[model samples]
Target: MAKRLLFIFMVFILGDIYFFQAFTTVFHTPFLHNAYWCIDLSLLIGVATLIFFQRQGKDIQRQAGDLITFFLIVFIPKLVALPILLTEDLLRMARGFPPRNIYLSEFVLICAALIVLVIAFGLTRGRHYYRVRKEILSFPDLPDAFDGFKITQISDIHSGSLSDVDGVRKGIALANAQNSDLLLFTGDLVNNKAAEMEAWISDFTLLKAPFGKFSVLGNHDYGDYTRWDNAELKASNLDRLKEIHQEMGFKLLLNESIKIQNKGASIALIGVENWGKGGFHQYGDLGKATSALPAESFKILMSHDPSHWDRVTLTHDQHVHLTLAGHTHGMQFGIELFGFKWSPIQYFYEQWAGLYQKQGKYLYVNRGFGYHGLKGRIGVWPEITVITLKKSVS
Candidate 1:
């Protein structure tokens, strides 16, 4: 792991050096050009520190995420500006015009301005811009008692990645303010160990719903990504994570079915362990989870990964009315504007975020309450999904 991180740090350094060299040639001032190198060196040191802490078995997700944000803020503008500037210079040559140094200087200044703006936004607004996405879903077979049942679902609260505890507390308070009938946490309460959530337990316990609070394990909850001292230690971590859910007043469902009642009417809610496509572990047993429920009963599934919905749940003999998941986190970045929503993860996972319906079955993939890897969200703001279930009058 250390070697891999070192390789990545080297690659980033080399890439930045290549890009900064272009600026050096454009400026033609030796001392001013050296200033750029100083900045690059400082950023490289930041990356090195992140890697060093990671190697020393420390949780530095927030620090690492900030470094990534800084890298993007600096590099992306140059990547775009340089291409456009070069293309314009080529067009000028074709028109019998000589390449002008002034034009290059202007382009550089514009690129610098853009970099400043990006950094300002990422640091000030990117992390705290939480959105409450309200979605209304209708089902034909939904019972009358559940017609107006409101569910607020949150997922992927990677507490270890959080740098601002106060901001996170506000997000949790927002979820509580919704006052929905039921609160469902799909998965990923922490990044790795159960201890990651120790500090935030009191904050999250404030999240309450009239019906009840229910949760399931996310891929990160198992601590599979980290190496432990022994097998027993790893097992103990997972067991403690389960107990943490109970302490938070949440019923942890592990390949089981529970009945939720309202106005003398009930629906079967099934939760399976993490079952994801690709390299993600497939510990979830859909058959075992729904085995005890009556075939004719209305059912809802709480799964961490959305890939399991179409691949396993829909194909199963027992039909599930709805599946709630949140593994994708919309890749923590994307463009959702002008009536269009897209993320690179879409190419890999068909159901990456938001709502999807096929042949009357529904899937709602929450954008996630917290974040991972890159730390701060870009275009894809952090989300708290409020879904209202309505009986179809049609």
Candidate 2:
């Protein structure tokens, strides 16, 4: 970790130097000069802060420090490179271009200013805004009793990262206001410890649905990432987390299936433990969970990571009509506009967010209800997804 940090620090310094040099060659204005210097100074100070925190210890303070340094380490270089690359594109368009230094400088400065505004907005308003996304899905196998059934799915609360109690309460209120028939939490109720959820248990417990609330374990729930005193303690922490879900009135499903009956019609709600692809935990057993269920039952699955959908659920013997998952969190950054959605995580996760259909099987990956490492969102805002199941018209 120390070596990695040092490498990042060196990269940051070099990138800052390159940006400063490039900007100075273009514009010699006193204001532009001072601003670039200030940015360089800030980058140096950020590196120093990271070293201090990392050397001192790893705690909430260190996590917060990492978040601060990450933004600079990741974005500062991109901000610098963007303009240089833009100038390269411009030069390619014309032969014997006289190197439009002034225009390049102005454009870079404008872009820098825009970045500041965007960061400020993302830190302030973006983290607090919870966008409620409603999706209506039609399935030929959906039972008539479940037709028009409204289900609300929220994932990756990461309660350990939340600092605003009122903001969370408001999000909870927004979810309850939907009046969905079933409430489902795909996973990651807490970051690492069950204690992180103590404060918000009351608020989350208020989430009501006639059919009931169901949830499954997420990668973070097992306390695998955190160092524990002993194996028993880690197991105890996971046990307590599962207990907390029950307290929140959620049926914590672990390789289990339950029947939801209404008006003599029935559907299976299967919950599997975290089963991710490549490096993530693979504790969920789809075969074991569905072993006793009737083969023809209309099934809805809750698996925390969407990778499972592609890896196993799609080709499973039993037809799972719809699967709910949330893990990528859309990398908490991306562009989502009308009919256009793209995130870097997409390259890593096929079903990162929103709904996807393949060979009649549907997967809906929630954007998550809370922030994670960065502690703030950009274009990919926190989400509360409401899905209505509609019976296909035939």
lDDT of 1 by residue, 1-394 (tens): 4676676556555556545645654778889888877777778799789879888998775677678777767655665565555665687788886645565656666776776685566555667678899989888788999998999999999887776878888898899889899999999998989999998888889999988999999999999877788999999999999999999999999999999999999999889999998888999998999888889899989999999997898889898999999999898777789869987678779999999998678899999888887757767888999999899976
lDDT of 2 by residue, 1-394 (tens): 4676677567665656545655776777989889767766765676677668667654444455355635644465455565575566577468665544666656665676676676666666777689999999998877899889999999999998888988888899999999999999999998889999998898899999999999999999998767777999998898899899999999999999999988889899999999998889899999999999988999999999999999999999999999999999898777798979987688778789898999888899999999887667777889999999899987
State each candidate's clash count.
0, 0
**Model 2, 378: alpha-carbon shift in Å?**
0.2
- Alpha-carbon error at 262 in model 2, in Å? 1.1
**Each prediction's whole-model lDDT (CA):** 0.84, 0.84
Superposed model 2: Cα runs more than 4 Å off: 1-22, 25-65, 68-85, 88-99
Report the C-alpha displacement of residue 240, candidate 1, in angstroms: 0.8
Model 2: lowest-lDDT 10 consecutive positions: 57-66
Using TM-score, give the best candidate's number: 2
